[model samples]
Target: MRPAYKQILEAVVVTAELTGSELSAHAQEVMVDDLMAYPLDAVLQALTRCRKELKGRLTLAAILDRLDDGRPGADEAWGVVARALGDESETVVWTEEMAAAAAPARELMMLGDKVGARMAFRDAYERIVSDARSERRSVTWRVSPGSDAERRVAAIVRAVELGRLPAAQAQLLLPTQAVAERHLLLTGSVMTEQERRAGREHVKKLLGMLRGGKVQVARTAG
Candidate 1:
């Protein structure tokens, strides 16, 4: 880890202690390594949000989980994290050289081309997901928010939310979005098969509600 990251981790550990929480030395190192993947400010913001929102004892894993929750700059800083896509049998891992290919999307976003960025990301992401699915593997990791499929959904969600894309697209993306959100929540945690099935069923309900229409919007009182 970089000296600066170690310094930040130390500061966070001290702050956690002041807040009546304890951060283990090993945990602190792990958090710093994971966080160093993003811009410094984005990592700090995630940590700050965790400190403000979590009650009771603060753990390093909890803070890292908060970062994965699509908090502000976290998603933007997510970039192309699809390091490797593992097969269903777990026998092989397919990796994509994404950073260079995905640079256009990042540039477009930086240039205020929200639509172009979203489109670019979606195109690259969908292509990746298609390959992964064909190999009978879930998108292992590609960025924050979850798998490549989930990231694709998130890209559409961002565009729609920004009014850069039509809400009609929401129906198409919401199902995968639900799956992605659940998959993300389940990461680094243990759960039963029943619970997993229940999660999928819950996400499926969204399909019926979204069918044949753009997402519904509530009107405010005039």
Candidate 2:
């Protein structure tokens, strides 16, 4: 099931259990809408942990508590939920743990600060890469794109190294370009000149964004 749907079902189930009053269909829909702003994986994981470890019972309060626990596994998910819940409840205040784990990137998006958002995401990428190297995990990208996102990421990083693109722009471009690349690779032999030209033009447009500074980067941390 989609995490959002699962969470909605579980929340209602938990509410009914704790209150002994079935939440009306309208109420259930409203709850789903509220929770939908959160990242699905985090919400689903929090719900699972809340049910399993929090006395095999669940409630919105219980789930919120689990999210607020700030334990190792829960911290990131909690950060995600906290950002989504932003100032909606008097009980929910911004916490340092949530900020460290998840807030900067989200806050930037909320403030219409795309440049700041890119910097934050780029920082996360650098941290993960550093961590992977320290742990001796393979950091090399494979030659072909395949299903290897890391390879695409590595290719993007390489572009940064070669001065072909900025790290932020490369990261932003690769995911979209990867889809285009996959399409071309899959259909290249059968593609007509016009089709190939169209694909090339699409790629040119993406690269143009980077060269033309269509996306911005921050000069200092915000």
Per-residue alpha-carbon lDDT of model 1 for 102-198, expressed as tens digits?
5557667667676677677656655544443334342222222234554456554554544444455344445453554434333524456786678
lDDT of 2 by residue, 1-222 (tens): 676587667765675565454566676666566556545665566566655666543445444443412222333434433434343321222223333434456677678775666567446543543343334343232122224454555555554554444444554546655544444334434566676678788888989888666435443333
Provide the clashing-pair count of each candidate structure: 1, 0
> What are the per-model C-alpha RMSD values against the true structure?
18.4, 17.0
Residue 139 in candidate 2, Cα distance off native in Å:
26
lDDT of 1: 0.50
Evaluate all candidate structures by whole-model CA lDDT and list the values in order.
Answer: 0.50, 0.49
Query: Lowest-scoring 10 consecutive residues by lDDT in candidate 1?
Result: 85-94
For model 1, what is the alpha-carbon lDDT of residue 192? 66
Error of 2 at 181 (Å): 30
Score candidate 1 by TM-score against the native.
0.31
